[model samples]
Target: MAKIYLDPGHGGTDPGAVANGLQEKVLTLKIALKTRDILNRDYEGHSIRMSRTSDTTRSLSQRTNDANSWGADYFVSIHINAGGGTGYEDYIYNGSVSNNTITYRDKLHAEVMKQVDFRNRGKKRANFHVLRQSSMPAVLTENGFIDTTADANKLKSDAYLDRIALGHANGIAQALGLKRKSGSGGSGKQGYVEVITPSLWTYNTANWDDKAVIVNEGEVFTVARDKFKVGNGHMYQLKSGLYITASTQYVRYYTK
Candidate 1:
């Protein structure tokens, strides 16, 4: 079994980044918890652990020590960015690491970019403590800029956070070759939708006016089928039972 260790950066008094009325600690924990839940519910043969599940203080060394003691196979540190920039970027240690670590990083970056509505800041390298000190392959992802209004708004959405979690979980499962629980139905080969507009409204029913949620641009979701008529054009039904416009102007459907 692969032992995965998740570290939610900054907690308690040390909120990593605070902007747009949001705390980095809270968002990181939310993503980590959701990621763990998704992995446990849909995948098998992997054991997951977190540095801090609640709002508690933890030093960088302490967190790494815990994972090292536990003999974690992989380490993923989740954090938010500040300093007036937007988009997603992840870091591996600048120093030499195993080829497995680089491969894992590539898979993670691709999966997260596929699922989240964020600009690609490119896969990067850094001398971050989490990466340098961890005994196993480690990746630290800065999801989005908390100081930027556009990115912060997405961070505030539970559904958006879930997408982030899904992306992270997807990467881990792929890197470890974790098997899908029988009938988990997340096997990407199914039809899916990728938002192309600034925002696409989903409806609980086929009616265009029956709005349910807003899926931001670049976000991807699995669809029930190819497409079906809704009004003047076509709509794609999400596996979540929500309907979205299948117009090429708003979304592009694909099967992986």
Candidate 2:
């Protein structure tokens, strides 16, 4: 499991950057909290620590020291960009630090850019205090331009922020080689396949066979086969795969 340190830039008396009614401190905190949630809930087993859980002020040195002292594998400082330009960008210190920093920063930039849909301001070298002083691999992300009305509006939405969180999680996952769990899929010798369409049914065979049992559409069952169809009328065939199903009435995609 990877240990991550998340720093939501600026708090308390300092709001970092502000424009279009969006405070950098507030936006940074929101994204940081959501990023922590995505890592803890979806990644599982990984550990995440935030620099500040609330609107408390901490200096850059204090934040970096905390992360280094805690033995964090990676450090991320989240901030909003301002001063005219719009879009996403990331920063790292000049010269080589460690392979981990380079790898993590590359993945982080890719993930955030994918979700933000802002100009790819590209990654550059900077002597930011957070990156310069941190013992672990660290990167500071400037999510978007608060000064731009278009970027500000995009940052205002919960869905947009969620995507940013997702990107952060994805970057961390990539760095740690963590595979994302498919919503309805599982893998193991004892894994089961769920039929969520038509009238719920489960098959327990390595392959979908004619003798697969028909449990209630909503019912969960262990499957022996990797492939099968859920209901009679549903044309969709579930390819051989593992699934995590729930206990409830199965909702058929089509009524027979």
Candidate 3:
């Protein structure tokens, strides 16, 4: 299992950067937490840890040390930049430019960039403390310039923060080749296709039984080993070992 350490830059007394109504510490923590949650909920085969789960202060040395001790495969430090610019940018240790860190950074940067309105500042390099000190591959991301008016307004929205978190989570998954772990039922695997219709019914039998569970809209699940045609519709096994609809009106996917 690959290990990833998320360090939400600055906390407690050290606010890091600030502007408008958003503080860098708070923003970073929010994004970092989201990233972790996404990785845990949607993917498998990862050991994820965080430097700080709350507003507790932590030093750079302490953060790196904790990750190092844990033998993390990757370290991601989340922060918001200052100095009146607007947009997103990411970094790796300067001297290790051509290494895997860049590959991971590039994937993450692209995922995040496509989802946000911030100006693309491009991937960069630096001698940041966490990058230079961490034994494993490390990156520090300046999500956006908190001091910029446009960027600050973007940060103020819950949706914007979700985009940032999604970008980072996708990057991590791409870098590690992590597989989808589950559907809405927490069955340890995601659905082959999303539930597009209002809802679909689970069957007690492949032939369509009298009573069954209701899988609602937006839920995903893996196709099962068994399938059968029931009237004008079809059914397949859910990852949960139950039967569900395989009809176009209920779900938008094909079983392998």
Candidate 2 — which residues are off by over 4 angstroms? 179-256
TM-score of each prediction: 0.78, 0.71, 0.71
lDDT of 2 by residue, 1-256 (tens): 7788999999998989988989999999999998987776665657888999999999998999899999998999999999999878888888669988888899988777555556678988898999999998999999989999878987887766866776887788788777555551222124333445566443343333443555553443444332222332111223443332222123212110
Q: Against the true structure, what is every candidate's RMSD? A: 7.8, 10.8, 11.1
TM-score order of candidates, top first: 1, 3, 2
Instruction: Give the range of the ten consecutive residues with the poorest summed lDDT in model 2.
Output: 247-256
Compose the digit string of candidate 3's lDDT tens values, residues 99-200: 688788888887776555567798888998999999988889998888888778778866567667877887888887888764523222333656877867
Among these predictions, the greatest lDDT belongs to 1
When summed lDDT is taken over every stretch of 10 residues in candidate 1, the lowest stretch is 225-234
Residue 142 lDDT (model 1): 97
lDDT, each prediction: 0.88, 0.72, 0.79
Tens digit of per-residue lDDT, candidate 1, span 63-174: 9999999999999999999999999999999999999999999999888876665778999999999999999999999999999998998898776787788889999999
